[model samples]
Target: MVEVEAAGLIAIGAGIAVGLTGLGAGIGEQSIGAAAIGAMAEDPKFFGKGLLMTVIPESIVIFGLVVALILLFVF
Candidate 1:
């Protein structure tokens, strides 16, 4: 019973880690994407920089996944 409880808690922690990160990244990406589109509209040359900037926030999601994996398997 104790082990089951521990496992459940661990799963919850992992889920929170991933869920929050994804939500944050999505929120961040929305603003960035809008700005990128705006900049690209003004000058086509800004597309590359805008795309790079927009993608940076997505790395947060990967970090979150890594944390969740570590929690689930290592903790």
Candidate 2:
């Protein structure tokens, strides 16, 4: 019974970690995406830089997913 409860808590924690990270990534990406679009509108040459900047925030979600998976499987 205790093990079950502990597993449930761990699951909850994992969910929270992933959810909060995803939210943060979304917020970060939103600002970057807006800037990217604005910069692209002004100069087409900024496309590569803007795309790189926009994609950088996605790493946060990837890290979060890895952590969640580790927590679920290892703990």
Candidate 3:
């Protein structure tokens, strides 16, 4: 019989923790980049607002990272 170690389980979860965030981030950036470019195509004046709004999705990734970090230290 084989026994599972807590550390190994925690390590696996940590890896997931690290990877899961980038999905939404990538989606966010794609939309933002596309929108920003579209806005630019229409009118260059939206450059600032478009760029700022595009990066708003970055918060999700950052929050995930913080949670992962906390988990890493927790277990």
TM-score, every prediction? 0.91, 0.92, 0.78
lDDT of 1 by residue, 1-75 (tens): 999999999999889989999999999999999999999999999999999999899898899899999989998
The lDDT of model 1 is 0.94
lDDT of 3 by residue, 1-75 (tens): 133576677667767866787787888789788989899889999999888988888887888777778767875
TM-score: model 2 vs. ground truth: 0.92
Worst 10 residues of 1 by lDDT: 55-64
Clash count of each predicted structure: 0, 0, 0
Per-residue accuracy of model 2 over 1-75 as CA lDDT, tens digit each: 999999999999899889999999999999999999999999999999999999898899899989999999997
RMSD of 2: 1.0
Misplaced by over 4 Å in model 1 are none
Candidate 3 local accuracy as lDDT? Answer: 0.80
lDDT of model 2 at position 56: 93
Give lDDT per model, in order: 0.94, 0.94, 0.80
